[model samples]
Target: MSRRSRPVVSNRVRRFFASFIFDKPAAAPASVIARHRLLNAGAYDEGSGTINGVMLIAVAAILISAVALGGNFLVCVSDARSAADQAAIAGAESARDGDFDPCIKSRLATTLNKAALVICKVDEEDVTVKVAVKTAVPFAPLVSRMARAGPVECS
Candidate 1:
């Protein structure tokens, strides 16, 4: 006897045919449904969502405030550094130009930049200066910076 060949079928096609022939589960009794409802009544309560949202908003606001304060402190520090450098350069230039007192000009420069001259030292044509800028933040110390400027000697 000659064997007849069968056509190949994909698993997807088999599953598609099988879906229409599955056994259905029996319906639950009314007592079981009531018990399930009673057991899960308090598991999904819904009053804390508002509280959680308010707490998240408060936390985000606090983070934004902290970042703003940190950025302001950084700007104050940069301003202090610039004031010191300008004062040092002024002192050095006065010394090179044969002025009477280089420190006086340095002090005036720092004051005009909203900073106080902390220290001034001149060694020949080189000038070193330290300046301080007061911060608006309560309980924060003054920002201080130091700088030196002089004419570079050619080799």
Candidate 2:
């Protein structure tokens, strides 16, 4: 073949193995080197695509779990608020009716709701209640709700 038609090799291998002095084999033609590089690039792209797919699935799963947890927490909050309101109203009505233990009436009102009363305050016909319920979440420290009720004394 004519010298002009022979493939030329650039300084690629020389840059990567600068310290090695062993007699290297004959350099491959430029076309062969380019083909090898393209094959490696395709393999790299395939591996990258697979990794990205797995990561996307994992992230989507985590996001779905978070949304479900938020919904459960909202239910807990709603139940807690209901318990507080009913307890406060019961306490106020008991006080108005001259019950011996108005706080006992408030406690009885929350019996079926599975809520624990943190505190109950009575001042004349007004009553306030603070309640809490256990949550099915991890690392939850404090979640409570408060409510107040009273009969308007027009005197």
Candidate 3:
């Protein structure tokens, strides 16, 4: 068999290849890397970063919508509770004044407070009323509140 001679790699090429492949891990001169984020940048589409940003925006929008809906629901609950308390107070006053039906006045009070009086009951100079308030939310959910007021009892 005839012996063949192998081509020798120059020191410069060896260093360049080493730096390209091994990241020049041995404190290589940054210049040989050639251009800061210029060429290798094209190797990747960077679309993943764009997708991540879009996903973040969508998540933020959903969170904001939830917060708004929750806030509206809380307001509706408070309004309903207030309306029920006011209606019960009005009914209690009517009972003290010897009204045959305090529910009629309670209905008027609930209406003035932007709520619908669902039920009213009177027993032993005590008045109890249930009221429902509707919110302007997407499905217009109603918040219901019940309150009772009676003459003060002292021992």
Candidate 4:
């Protein structure tokens, strides 16, 4: 019996030639090629240093704003409490004279000078005094209004 023999090409040899010498289309997909090119492109490259710098600046700005807001709130509350105390004292002193308008005006003036809005009134029949304090926080072109401890003394 006679046997026929076929020509053999090693897989590695074929692959090497096919990759380097063949005129066939690239095996890599278009999307993959585009992605590789984009990754290596200098214009699209963003170094870690630039990104970190921007993040640091953003964090600093946020921290500073938080501190400023807290400080402003503290000042507003302190001024409001002082004004309320003054109003109470004046109201008590004026109660004997049956004239509360002077005391109310004095309290309002004190708060207004300290960037606080105040409304003070005394009920003659009930002998109760009420004080309202409003303060504005500074934010450019935006009104940040807050009211603090309204009607400090109802009775």
Residue-level lDDT of model 2, residues 106-152, one tens digit each, is 88877768888889989888999999887766756346999999998
> Lowest lDDT 10-mer window, candidate 4?
141-150
Off by over 4 Å in 2: 1-41
- State the weakest 10-residue window (summed lDDT) of model 2: 15-24
By TM-score rank, best first, the candidates go 2, 3, 1, 4
Candidate lDDT values, in order: 0.88, 0.84, 0.88, 0.54
- Candidate 3 matches the true fold with a TM-score of 0.68
The true-structure Cα RMSD of candidate 2 reads: 9.8
TM-score of model number 2: 0.69
Q: Give the distance in Å from residue 70's predicted Cα in candidate 2 to where it truly belongs.
A: 2.0
Tens digits of lDDT, candidate 3, 63-99: 9998899899999999999999999999999999999
**What TM-scores do the predictions have?**
0.66, 0.69, 0.68, 0.47
Give the per-residue lDDT digits (tens) of candidate 4, residues 12-53: 557656876777544665775798898888646667779999
* Model 1 steric clash pairs: none
Better of 1 and 3 by TM-score: 3
Clashes of each: 0, 0, 0, 0
Query: Model 2 clash pairs?
Result: none
Angstrom error at residue 25, model 3: 27
